[model samples]
Target: MFGTKVIETFKEEHTGDVLDMMRDFEVKKRAISEEKEGNIVLRIPAAFAETYKSLNSNPISKHIFKGRFTETTKLKRDKLNINVGVSKQFIARSVSNNIEHAKRILAENECSNISTILLVGGFAESEIVQERIREAFPNKRVIIPSESGCPQRSSSSWS
Candidate 1:
């Protein structure tokens, strides 16, 4: 329960293996307003004994966390500590590499005379990407359409 809303609920029989269950859950799409760093607590039904047993039996689980797990019956939820530092670094690197590639493309194609750089698509919505592009090409005007995904109309809606 994340502040009173249930995100996911699964039957005990469905999640036979704990490791595979956790991996599958982690890969699923989740909505977050902003990026944050903290341990994500998952509240599973008490009947899910595989979660507890796997944590105890598997030494491979230690690869996820250096901290010790303290199981408490009084607690309603179980805590899963995962470090996304590597994943975050990978995304940052990919963004940087793409920006560098854009620069190379411009240079190789002799696009120096191009006055305006219009960024469209979903990736253009990223403030970091927009900021970096503006910084990279100080002289060129970086224009990001307000509703990038939507086509702009020249005439009034009534007409």
Candidate 2:
């Protein structure tokens, strides 16, 4: 069928390029599924997926954007730390608010012994976002990964 050819073409051309971009990130885990609307799904390793699953099960935690935010909490040395996604467009506008929320969560958990604050996902790469976070938490160590990788574009036309 025509749809099959389109999917094949997409996999051969576009999908490979996108996956190649993520290759440097050491993305050892990958999952792919076919959707009903002739769409192929690719899931990457991130806390967002877990948060999304939780949002689905709990209506109270519903996010404004369906695909934007994923919140995760981790315990370090008996301190509870929460990380929320700010990469998606809708959530991007409220980066400062999200940072405040994180700080409040950390405070509520009585985690004065907390170590570093980690920022992941695409928004973490923004200079503005980073600067805002640094301004807010001047003393806290903020960690961002080095090999986050870059977006890919077609190189076939160059040759």
| TM-score per candidate | 0.43, 0.36
Model 2 root mean square deviation, Cα atoms = 17.7
lDDT (Cα, 0-100) at 154 in candidate 1:
72
User: In candidate 1, which residue ranges exceed 4 Å CA deviation?
Assistant: 1-88, 149-159
lDDT of 1 at 111: 82
Q: How accurate is candidate 2 locally (lDDT)?
A: 0.46
lDDT of each: 0.50, 0.46
Q: For model 2, how does the per-residue alpha-carbon lDDT over 34-113 read when each residue is reduced to its tens digit?
A: 11122122332223323334435533223232232223333333222323222222234567688879788778758777
Query: What is the Cα-based TM-score of model 1?
Result: 0.43
Which pairs, if any, clash in model 2?
none
Instruction: In model 1, state the lDDT of residue 88.
Output: 39
Q: For model 1, how does the per-residue alpha-carbon lDDT over 24-74 read when each residue is reduced to its tens digit?
A: 444321211126444334444443434444444533223232222332112
Each candidate: RMSD: 10.7, 17.7
Candidate 1 lDDT: 0.50
- In candidate 1 the C-alpha lDDT for residue 121 amounts to 60
Clashing pairs in 1: none
